[model samples]
Target: MLTYTPAVQHAQPPASERPWLLLLLAFVWLWPGVFAHDLWAPMEPQLLTVIEQWRNGGHWALPTLFDRPYWEAAPVYVWLGAASQAVFSPWLLDAYEAVRLVNVGLMAIGFCCIGGAARQFLGRRFGRTAVLVLIGCPGLLMPAHLMSTIPLLFTGAAMCFYGLSLAKARVIMASLMLGGGWVLLALSGSLLLSLSLMLLGACLPLSPHWRYRRYYLVLPTALLWAWPQMLLWPYALYQADTAAFFSWWQQQALMPFGGFGQIQFDFSLWYYLKNLLWFAFPAWPLAIWSASRLRLADSDWGILGMAWLALLGFLLAVSPLQFQDLLVILLPPLAVFGAAKLDALRRGAAAFLNWFGIMTFGLLALFLWLGFAAMNYGWPLKLAERAVYFSPYYQTDVDYFPILVACVFTPLWLWAITRQHVRGRQAVTNWAAGITLSWSLLLTLFLPWLDAAKSQRPVVQQMQKAFDADAVRRLQAGQECVSVEAGNHTARIAWQQYGWLTLDVDNPHCRYRLVRRSPQATTPAAGWQELWAGARPREKREWLALWQRLPAKPTEPAKTLQ
Candidate 1:
């Protein structure tokens, strides 16, 4: 067995060489803020809605989405999301920030682990290169957003991988990592559980320790870790009927049909390859040549590479659901490969890589410019008028940003071919990688400005205006803590963010009050009022009638017994 130490310790870079590492670290921390100004908005409406239902003495049963009973989504994420809200009851900022911040922290930890672990498995120089590729990979960069659980999922997996590297040391510790990882996967859902366990079993050699020891500690620890979450699983299941509980996952699986499926297949598969090429850009040809130069049979890192590829293949094959973000799981291993190939590049192979890196940045800048130009200057004008200011002949559309960005690197690519005639290559490759890193930093930082130009819906802003704390408190103080009726999810978000007692809706939460808003219904208790408004005639009439019948606000507080 081979032993490895930290890269910083074994091969310390000069003080001047530290800027790239610092830049990567800084971006890792700030990346989430770029794409998502209101990171929690998309999830808040559903989760807060469910939480309000639970607080109203509702049974924790089938999950609900947008107020309707939704089953397929496992309760783990919902539970955690609600817990964050619960802790900071009556104020959502803390809870919202907590979930997003945790994810950001997790991404940083995962990146560092990949770098350190790669150094141990590969070599110091290769590990450094791997770290650079890991940071710069578009596949890894885009999904740092907090809306998804991929960050958590990747962090858990990284922990397991890094721990496996330590198996020769205390078996208990290594097994603990594996166990914790499996618990996370299980909580995530059956799909993740199946995939993770399959990979672990395939990659790991079955130890006599696990098989023979009646005193084994790993399994027990895992059970202990999972017990709390699993306790809620049965309750949720009992509450959900046969058809309602599995609906969310089924919906997720089926959503890939038609045009979306074709787009996903192309982007998820080809993008991963393209992302790798861009990460190493000007250095790519030499890296590829270097890779071709080596025989895998002699490479110590070969098994790890194969394992990484296998996991990626398995994920894509089995996921009835797929997205570009899901491909992040493949990044660490690819980083290792890229780094190793870079290490193999000779000193003469430089000019090509440098020019390539420069062009990569130049292209990225152009994309950024076009995205703005279309949104502000182009879209506002009539089509013919817009053509006067832009390249009208091609019917140039802004959505072609991806293609244009890809094209921008054409110059570096041309220079790369011509570099075969040049003698000095070392200076070029290093300068190119450095400049590319700078471009990545600038592009990511400027992402926030670009988001303003995109015409994405303002979901968070709408919620911010809709939630009213005082109204929610009055409602909670006046009515039953839980109420189930139409418009519960909307009510729940209003209540939870404002500290109202949860009224039951057939949301993710269990206990709910039954309320009817029809015209024939009796008057509401004091302080009760109808809040929903829409264009539907009958529902609108019902809401108006409910508004008139709402019970008067209570003036006196109810006495409580000690």
Candidate 2:
């Protein structure tokens, strides 16, 4: 039998390359994609809407969108975002931008906790490698930068890992982390995940490696710490409004389990497995190699990591899978497990990863540059035409600052990659650098174009123009409210934010109504006249149309009385 060796036995890097330096690099990697852009569609706007509602004196216990209770998740993340916005939006940032800062903080916490876990499990030096593996994950990049609860969820999971790693030696600290992580997972709108972690903690004693006297205190201590926090929000919400509480309970707690029965036994069950190919990437390959070499009983941390991965994988398999559902939970365990065996990685594999990152990102960055040139200069006629095809209304203007930034980073990336040696940690570092460089280039070079395509500001602006023209015809002044019919939450929020229009979906008496429809769909339903029709520049199918209620024909004079 092949014997397993602790990762601490491997040669360590110089003191100059410390975990703090890796964290600093991670901070740099996190900021660019976050700061420069407006909230992009599908999720960011929805989160902002919830925060806006809360800020506008909506009840803290129940999160509402356009005055309707939204019970998809708990309001913990929304509350945090509201506080962040309140603190920062006054002077430093826009509302959405301010909320996004929470993402940065959550990711920072996640990095630290995961690094701490790695240090406990593998060795002191392996912490940096674990963090690098996480930073390099393609799955983490977009979600981490967005205004979503997933980052909080990721942080919570990282805390659980860190707490689990500390169970044998630091019982009190481990219990607190475990319990606190459970609360975070619950509050972040995933009760199921919180429960899973709790169960995982309870089962730890069953493992031969973790059957120590101190380990038994972990779960009960975690539970004692967690129960009050877990109940506090729900109980307050219930006391505030029973109906809304039940709605939230049904959706948040009961619905996840109910959803499993609804899932068909189809190819969709393999969703995480399929996406793991690109989502987990470098980490998954390394984790598989590590797992292959080590027995389940080899290390307590290894057992815990594997169990956590399996539990999450099973949960994801049975439950419905959306793009955002994968979050950062899956990556940290993989990183911990993978980082342990970094030195054991064969030379050819390390070199391949290094070159693969270089070649892939090198070409991608080159293409992104070309696309930017096409957007600004129309130098490459074909690519320029494609750009125009996507965003017809987007005008060509050179933003020299982003261009300069991208210009500097491109050569810097080339320099960094060329100088790096093909060692295990170096390979992972190269991958992380490549991801950061590519994402930075996209956010910098293509930000304007991306914003043009994704932002609802332009769409709302067009609707505003039409509404203004109609308002002028009616000789109305000041802001006028409009009722929305069939308009999505995104459009409703966008109208209020950009167009400064008060939207009441429940108001039947409002004169104007906004309707959303596919481009191929027929006219608005009877009694409303279409005033304006438009969609985002890149939106090919769906469009929003502004309509005014046709004035009720004056009742015919009472001829019968005459």
Candidate 3:
């Protein structure tokens, strides 16, 4: 017997690594109530109304906002919202809650896709790391929870990559993914062009079984059913509407593909980087490092991810990228790039990351908690004052339910901190755990305040009340409804909120009129008596002007109001 030393196998990992449980717990922590917060200004309300119009009309093609076709091409979320609204309409107070829950579900699915793909390419250790990169980014917080196209776009990007990963091994699944993923991308408003371009990018990165992929791609193309089958939501405008469409599109995509035009776009390269500096966070720094070592990264997935990064950059550079657009361009590839180098994290990097996460999120949680305590318990004098000043109308309510939920989750997050075995000893462990805590506390403890400050309800109510204490009564008594023009997105939101009291959406000569701009800057062509004017102080641009017609002049037509 040659030294029969009993080879002791290291203690086996748990029977179930419990991927589903971890993912679910993460979601539970990060995912807030759909109706817990308000539809924020700038994007949320505008997008909300677009979806509302879609569901209200029951037509498939994207509806026009104000009068022009929205042409966002982000129909997946709208369709999902419509479907969920159909199911939850009778019961739910806010149909957006259903749409929101669907968002959470899709979000969870996207996490699964990221983890699954990471497990295959980068191995089990980095699969969890991928999730950390996603949630830890501070920028993702608002965008992640928002009722906008970004959620689906982010999730779809993950699916597109995962589908690419499965292309070789699971041809049927790959075809389904490629087809379905591209369609979802196209449906995500104004991304159809991006979709077609990315498809070409996907093709350039060749792996084995190249011949089989052509067939895979072909099959999915059929499933797209671009024009004919899309009649369910057939929302495109006619050739006559081309001028308006291009005009709107031009605003967002300034000097787009500028090489084709004499108008050379600077691309705001520095500005884009500045935004990414904080928005992209550790992933941005880590991605830069990973990009430096691309040659040494895992063979196929690394290159494929790099290709995506290149494409996204090209698009962002060429187009006038909005801040929201970063969710699509920077994040997904950052996760991939970060995941590729997970195992290679030096002890120093790990320690830095651990401390960075611990501080960034830990302080965030503390500040949020302080704010909550200040509001509910009136502990901190200064913080409480600020909170009150910001949202004076936000009354404190001791809601037992969210408090109870927070009590459970607060300890759960603390437990997670100690339970290293649960998520593993990866560098990203602390960041993920910290973010989850921050999300949980913010949603549960600080939600009421957020709803007060952010929701359009108070703003709309105040504006209405300012007009007259019984303005609603006057409108309800079959009197003239207020005249509202489809102004900018901000005013459109107010218009939608106050639409019920309106005499007619198209009416201009109506006695009571709602003008978006200040009365002094531009008054009605027919002189008007300014009834009441106020604005949500939070947004300087939103100046709500309510006017009563002085007298009608023959020269002032409804079109003149334009």
Candidate 4:
């Protein structure tokens, strides 16, 4: 065992002291009620309905909504969320909160893992600082606010870093983490880029040294991670859903979009560099300056760091989907280089970066004030009154103006602070602290109303009300009068909550049933009486005349089809 030296022991920071402050900020930003509940929440309920079915000793057939089973994607996330909810809380509220909490927790774990790996390479303080930067990274920050794939992506990346770090250890454990990391990545999205990195790590010319033994272990682990998709390939082929692009990556022939081969790109090849400037924010300038100095160092680890950056650059250039989140994988190596550079800087360089960060935030504050208070609160509202312009896909100048300004000002901020002077380190520290504090406070105030509007409250309420209505309950007792709410809105709510069991003529579940609008329309089998017809709230006035009559009583619970 490696003995824990006082020096090393001192090097490891206490959890509270080691940037737990960032966790609070992260929790605030990522917490629900601040952002529109993630669009993926509906998908969770869909998964839970299936899990509930299975728990009742039902078989593992895929779940159906609108009478169609959704079978293409893997069931891991849903199962995990459902099982977690079941364990923690039997209440619906508990179930919803559990999924959100677990996702947030996983992301926090990812940050910790990232910090740990950085500590291994860059000493303790710098590692935590890097994590702090990542927490505030605008690209990561926005996604972290949602309950989508970002948390899982963070977890998988952390796993890969950990596994690679362990390469200097015994083979079996390293293989498992490495394999597990790739599996997680596959679940989130493509594994091509990560697989390439691992392959390069394994096949480097420096093999045969003790240090390189870990390299060989990576290949077998990658092979293991790929087993699930490999096994599914035949079925996917028969289904005409083969992942042909991934298989053809080695052919060296570019596909419809530019690439090294059959691999296609959604954006142009230079996307990574473009997104990096915007996504990285204030830290990017520091990263570039740090990289420039490191390039001239000629040290072994410095060379390795450069190699990692080079690989990152290459992958970004070749990737099909050049989204900002992909640049996250670059943080680990960047952290190392950043720590080294920061350690070398006198107080002046640190101060400059700090001031740069502050100016960036100050500019963001001004932009938001003008865009929202001046434009959205003033001019846009007046226009909205005349035009009645509110749609789910609505975009405004206010929505993107700050993002544009952030993109342009970020580089200039870096440029102004390029020179080194170690004297201002204290000022730099104060500047960073202020940025983090201001962001947290501002978001706390700004997010709630936006989140409320974004939430599924109106939709959830309508469904809850309809299901709880006397008419709905009476139908559950097996009468024959059924009225489909006007428009497909209620049908959507019904299908999401009850799946195939819902019976409304407008709904596919009720497609085969005869739909009578009112008491005057039709007489049912004996014991069935038409009930008052009701339409969706917004459509009620338009359908008022048609819905003026009594509603129908439902029949014996309809036989449910698979």
TM-score per prediction, in order, is 0.55, 0.90, 0.81, 0.60
* Model 2 pairs whose backbones collide: none
> For model 2, how does the per-residue alpha-carbon lDDT over 1-562 read when each residue is reduced to its tens digit?
9998767665545434555657657877888867666678667887888888888998888888777877653488888898999899869987878888988998898998999999998887888889899888888888788877778788899988888888877999999998889998888654778888888877777878888878788878889989999988889889989987776666556334532323232224466678888888788998988888787567888788878888877777676544535646788789888898887788888899998999999999989999998989896999999998887767676789988988888887787788544677888888998998899899888888888788878887777776456585452443455777643776777776776666767568777777788887757778888888888875667788877889778898766663
Per-residue lDDT of model 4, residues 233-275, tens digit only: 3244334423433333333222223334455645444677788
Top of the candidates by TM-score: 2
Local lDDT at 373 for model 3: 88
Q: Model 2, stretches more than 4 Å misplaced?
A: 1-21, 258-268, 467-470, 473-481, 504-511, 549-562
**Weakest 10 consecutive residues, lDDT, candidate 3?**
252-261
- TM for candidate 3 is 0.81
Q: Rank the candidates by lDDT, best first.
A: 2, 3, 4, 1
The digit string of per-residue lDDT tens for model 1 on 125-149 reads: 5445555555545445444544455
Give the alpha-carbon lDDT of every model. 0.47, 0.79, 0.64, 0.49
Better of 1 and 4 by TM-score: 4
Q: Backbone clash tally for model 1?
A: 25
Q: What TM-score, to 2 decimals, does candidate 4 have?
A: 0.60
- Local error of candidate 1 at residue 224 (angstroms): 9.4
Better of 2 and 3 by lDDT: 2
| Clash count per candidate | 25, 0, 15, 27
